[model samples]
Target chain A: MARTAGSHAETTGPKVRAVALRLFARYGYAAVSMRQIAAEVGVQAGALYNYTPDKQGLLMSLMQGHMHDILEARQATSSEGDAVQQLEAFVKFHIGFHLARPEALFVSYMELRNLEPQNFARIEALRRDYENELEGILARGAAEGVFTLDDPKISTLAIISMLNGVVNWFRPDGRLGLGDVEQIYWGMVRRAVGAAE
Target chain B: MARTAGSHAETTGPKVRAVALRLFARYGYAAVSMRQIAAEVGVQAGALYNYTPDKQGLLMSLMQGHMHDILEARQATSSEGDAVQQLEAFVKFHIGFHLARPEALFVSYMELRNLEPQNFARIEALRRDYENELEGILARGAAEGVFTLDDPKISTLAIISMLNGVVNWFRPDGRLGLGDVEQIYWGMVRRAVGAAE
Candidate 1:
């Protein structure tokens, strides 16, 4: 009986998170209920509590998971290049990473207001860590006299925001391929910072 | 009796929209019901239908009203000048206009998924019209040899996304005032298009 329950949890846990993410992305987090998630996951409402304490816990977990995934993915990429190379790598990596997880990206941005204060702070800290990585690149380029920037922090936010906009309209079968987008956007980012061609 | 009914709608119409917008922004659209909107507006749930056919109608109206408001505001601004000057005007106008209506902006982006197919198409058309305005500017600048852009359409979307990002974090009492933000953002916009200093 104990072994059966353990294995059940192991399989059901991922299914619960996946179904919850889809529902939350389709309907905002506040609108999605634990019972609704359980129904979607083919589990009893009581079984959900065994996995997640409540709706808020599930939301926080999803959001934290997304942030951690992105941060870890970013960390895995090589950061050995100069500021311009680093910035380009960052742009492509961000666009590709976000594009691959549209639902997670949507939930991460939209459901932020629903996070508890402590959870919000933790997620925000993780976000800041990501933003700071780009800011550091801009600062290095400016200091090295390779890029001219009015404000590294603002530029960091602006670039990320601009890159994020791609997910809103990009389609796998769209006219422009992802590689084309990366190049065009990298061009704009390079120019935005007054980096020479 | 007719005059009283007309007067009631005239007053209640705006109130309904205001309450609905607030609730939709605070709680996702799917979570908020017609009764909640009516209660907040001090009206009976059935009375809410007098103003809107259904919850979807209210959502459609609010989203449409926002788009029309911005489009009309954009029209009101003078478009006379070189491309660089015109782009500056657009950047400042967009930031100031969106910053003033944070709730509307939030709902406009967040509730887009909740819009019905036809309603989504209409909102998207309005959005494209806005994007076209910026694309025209970039095209003109590129043609006149004042700006260098790899793709005008892509740049249009990118610039708008960057500007729209300000709504996510701008506060009146924050360290920087609106004017300071406009100047900083405008500087980035000017450079992003490869505009000459």
Candidate 2:
């Protein structure tokens, strides 16, 4: 009996999160309920509690998971180059990572207002850490005289926002492949930062 | 009595929209109900139908209204200048207009998925029209050899996305004033297209 429950929970935990994310992304977070999430997960409402304490907990977990995933993915990529190369890697990584997880990206951006203050701060910190990575690249480039920037911090936000906009309209089977899109953006980014050719 | 009723609706119409926009921005559209909107508008639930056919209509109207407002605002701005000057106006106008109406911008972006298909199409057409305005400038600039771009269409989306990001974190009281932010972004925009100095 104990072994069965343990295995069930291991499987069910992921199921609960998946269902919850879909429902929340489809409908706004406030519009989704724990009971509804449970129904979608094929579990009793009581069983959901065994996986997540409540809706807020589930939201925080999803957001935090997204942040951590992106940060980890960013960490795994090569950062062993000059500022221009580092900036290129950052741009490509950001676009590819965000494109692959549209739902998580949507939820993370859209549901920010719903996060409780404490949860908001935690998520913001993680986000800042991510932003800081790009800012660091810009700063290094500016310092090395390879790139000209009025404000590295503002440039960081502008570059990320421009890249994030890709997920809004990019289709994998569209006329342009991902590589083409990345190259186009990198060209613009390189120019935008006044990077040396 | 008819005149009085007409006048009442004229006054109440904007209120209903204002309340709905605020509520929808605060809570996702699905989580907000017609009754909640009516209550906030200080009217009976059924009376909201007089203002809007249903919750969807309200959402559609808000999104449509936002698009029209921006389009009209863009039209009002002077498009008379060299391509570089026109692009500068666009970047500055975009950031200022969007920043001034954060709630509308937020709802317009976040509730796009919630728009009914027909409504979505209408809003998209308007958005595309807005995008084309920028594309025209880029095309002109490229043709005139004032700006270099790999793809004018892609560059248009990228520039607008970068500018639209200002609303996400810009504060009037923050370290940068609107003018300072605009100038910084303008510099980046000019460089991003490889415009002649």
* TM-score of candidate 1 versus the correct structure, residues matched by position: 0.90
Badly placed stretches (over 4 Å) of model 1 are A1-8, A33-36, B1-10, B35-47
Per-residue CA lDDT of model 2 for B58-160, tens digit only, reads 9999999999999999999978889999988999999888878888987888898888889889998999999999999999999999998999988988988
- Residue-level lDDT of model 2, residues A1-197, one tens digit each, is 23344448778899998988888878778877888987877776888888887789999999999999999999999799899999999999988888788788878988988899999999999999999999999999999899989999999999988988887878888888888889999999999999978
Model 1 Cα lDDT, one tens digit per residue, A1-197: 23344457778999999999999988788777888998887777888888888889999999999999999999999988788899889999998898888889889988888888999999999999999999999999999999988788888898888988888888989999988998888888888998887
* Residue-wise C-alpha lDDT for candidate 1, range B39-65, written one tens digit per residue: 998877888888888899999999999
- True-vs-predicted CA distance for residue A129, candidate 2, Å: 0.9
Docking class of 1: medium
- What's the alpha carbon RMSD for model 1? 3.3
TM-score of each: 0.90, 0.90
Point to the candidate with the largest TM-score: 2
Off by over 4 Å in 2: A1-7, A33-36, A44-46, B1-7, B35-40, B43-46
